[model samples]
Target chain A: MHETAIAKAILDRITDRLNNLHHASNATAVEVRVGEFRNVDPESLSFAFDSLKKEYPTCIACALNLELIETRALCKDGRHEYKASADNAYRCPNCGSAIGTLVSGKELDITKIVVSQNK
Target chain B: MHGPTELHILERLLEDNEQLASHNQEHFDELGLLAVNLMSAPGAGKTSLIKSTAKLMPADCPIAVIEGDMVGELDVERLREDNIPAYQISTGRACHLDAQMVAQLLHTTKLPDCKILFLENVGNLVCPAEFPLGEHLRIVLLSITEGDDKPIKYPVIFHNCDAVIFTKSDLLPFCKFSLEKAKDAISSLNPAVEFFVVSTISGDGLPQWRNWIVEKANKKISHLHIGL
Candidate 1:
């Protein structure tokens, strides 16, 4: 539901990074990384970006490429690491202690922006 | 005529919101307010919990509420009727209240001197999890009527919450809500989250909940001095 807000933020970020490209030039692509625990529907985010990009002349031709990251968890013993789930998430499979530390699963970031350098 | 240049940048998608959230927190700190973000699905007894808490809390513990909704000011009106200091932020299009909206509320409304500030986010289990509004604590309410599978379905919201409150506990007998299952599902996702089963009408867990709020308030006050 708030994907539009995210998209706008990403566009603003890229615009700021572009640094005064006075003449209009199309954005080639924008790469984003969406983690499993982010609760973002990639399709919806892409749809939002597409709709928003059309309104901006610089991003009209831009393509949004989203890479989904899987949820990963580590146990207390540090010997056990696996994908996170509704069950047995924190429990160390070997030691049987509940201390599953989440390493990565909440990453929602714009990794890179590809744009035509002809400004 | 130049080729495409790939500018490597690893930045959070909601970085702007997070920055504003920090700014909001600084303002809250300046005012000595412990802001708590209240979240849940629509009709998950958020308003009831707020009303009941306000009624049962220790009289001297001043509390304020920031109501967020897609539209309308009904919640603010309700709080006013109860003589509770409250403000409202309506995100007409957005499903959830982000930090910027709450910051806007802070700028416009004169919040009373409060130990605790409850920011009741727009009822949502999904989007609200993605946006933080500079809260000292985050509590998500789930009613028995919503079923126990909510934790399984909305893991993000459940995982991010500092506490999980099962509201409308009186309906536990009539509904198929399994408290144990809900707890198990949530614990696997987040072991540290405190769970409370309460029925505002019955006042079953109000005492414990009230105590928790006071403790949090005290902690925040002490932390303010000690810099935590």
Candidate 2:
């Protein structure tokens, strides 16, 4: 699955960031935001991350925090804001518009990282 | 006593892929090749459509392809048999092709100087949408045999694509697939997405589809010339 690749990327980023820090010993936790439209399963991602992190000493025991964002869209009319879901076929529920500006749900970002400092 | 400190490093997880995708795009731009990424689920007739489109393309405007599959070069062999320059990338374990995979191929191989380069992505619909492979145009195919509810179920892929090709029209009468419902669902997610209905056996929409591709490729060339 692509989640394994994503997990590797996350671990690589974490390790890179840790190495750049002056006194950082290892990463303790990492926070990431994923959107609904990304097709990433949180549980699968977590499992992959946990499995892969063992290879990287810098983030071996790091906890991964995943925040899944909802898919929301703004109608072309610029007034109707609706949750894009299967029920409405991702169209604007109120305006019945086919095209809508996506407000969220495409995000796949690492927001924060916590690291242990070398005393 | 220094404890664990929290650092805010707000960055995209796919930053590497995105950067490489842009680099690949620049390379294609320099070559004046219209890079088209064809993505769809398994067995949606991507290789067949490519073969049909290659046949329809003008003699002056040639086409090359980079086929992605989980294993084997069956599609690549098929394309090569038709005298189409094709390369195969067997993505072991990975469900989708990333920009890096394409970048490596570009580095290793020298493709024929064609007006268009078609990248037929691996057969999965879900993960391929997440990775951008430096394509100027992205198209998704939906075979009628796959049912009309696919667009609604996989909205992300449908929404991000430039167009959708409804394939296997020859079997439409036998299947319960409704073109109207499929179009409605996809247009709801992406109103700008163009639709093409076709069957490789009958060549129903091959001409129109070929024309659209040629027009787009010419437009790309002209647009670059104008910029210069």
Candidate 3:
């Protein structure tokens, strides 16, 4: 039940965005921003989308583009920085204080959707 | 018509989940409750600790528990037998518990009027740490039988936790467990996390652990009253 709920939520978000796209554009692309802190499996999401597309034939031609946004942890020292890797360990290069606040990276959103209507 | 065009699909998938978690946090704070997210590997004595803690809680202080498991309501049944208000969250196959699941349970379950609510996360160290459930405190349990390397093997969970509880300390003599090594390893990952070593069976070190919890809970309540 939990797995299906998660799968359905992802698919619903993807398809909702797809259906809301401007029909005038004939582009087959969509950009999804996944936050590093969300900790969702990209492969599982892709698999869910692939299976979801089987029900909606129009989505088969659409290309799903994933953009990973890395989460940054603020260090205790006077250094402001963001992480660029999957590693959640963001330490201050100056003073070795683990007191770092999360700057950004827990974003899971569909930024935009492009559909082809000319074909 | 084959030219490249950019479409920005910026939408936060977890926004709803986060909002719900925040709501749960607010509810807990309003009730003067300290909600704890208990995480550990299976057979790490999470339920045992709950039973012990519940027994030690003050008579006037109401205690409730939210038990998360992949299947079965055995833990819930045990809690019920103990006369504690308990709710079971069976995730079926999910390895971890998320905020949304807890939020749904809070809405559906007939929780007890309590000052402290313990959410025993699905017995896993990995995924539960990934999602925040708006808990005031996150406590990770490590049994001596599980070995000392667990702190290193699962650093993220330890790194994020507010405290660590070393359970099954009574079995230390029977098992090859190194307390100093585990403490050193955990300190390496999270130097600020509080540590409590307790053996439920022998009642050794349980008082200190219980006092720490009571102190923390009292501080939380005081802070709430002060609008902190």
Classified by CAPRI criteria, candidate 3 counts as: acceptable
Query: Which residue pairs show backbone clashes in model 2?
Result: none
- Per-model TM-score, in order, reads 0.93, 0.96, 0.79
Model 3 error, position B217 (Å): 2.4
RMSD of 2: 3.0
Off by over 4 Å in 1: A20-24, A76-79, A86-99, B221-228
- Go through the candidates in order and give each one's DockQ: 0.62, 0.67, 0.32
- Give stretches of model 2 more than 4 Å off: B221-228
Fraction of native Cα contacts kept in each candidate? 0.77, 0.92, 0.35
Most accurate candidate by TM-score: 2
User: Which digits, one per residue and each the tens of the lDDT, describe model 3 over residues B67-118?
Assistant: 9999999999988888988888888767888777888877776666787789
Candidate 1 vs candidate 2: the TM-score winner is: 2
DockQ of prediction 3 = 0.32
Q: What is model 1's DockQ versus the real complex?
A: 0.62
Ranking by TM-score: 2, 1, 3
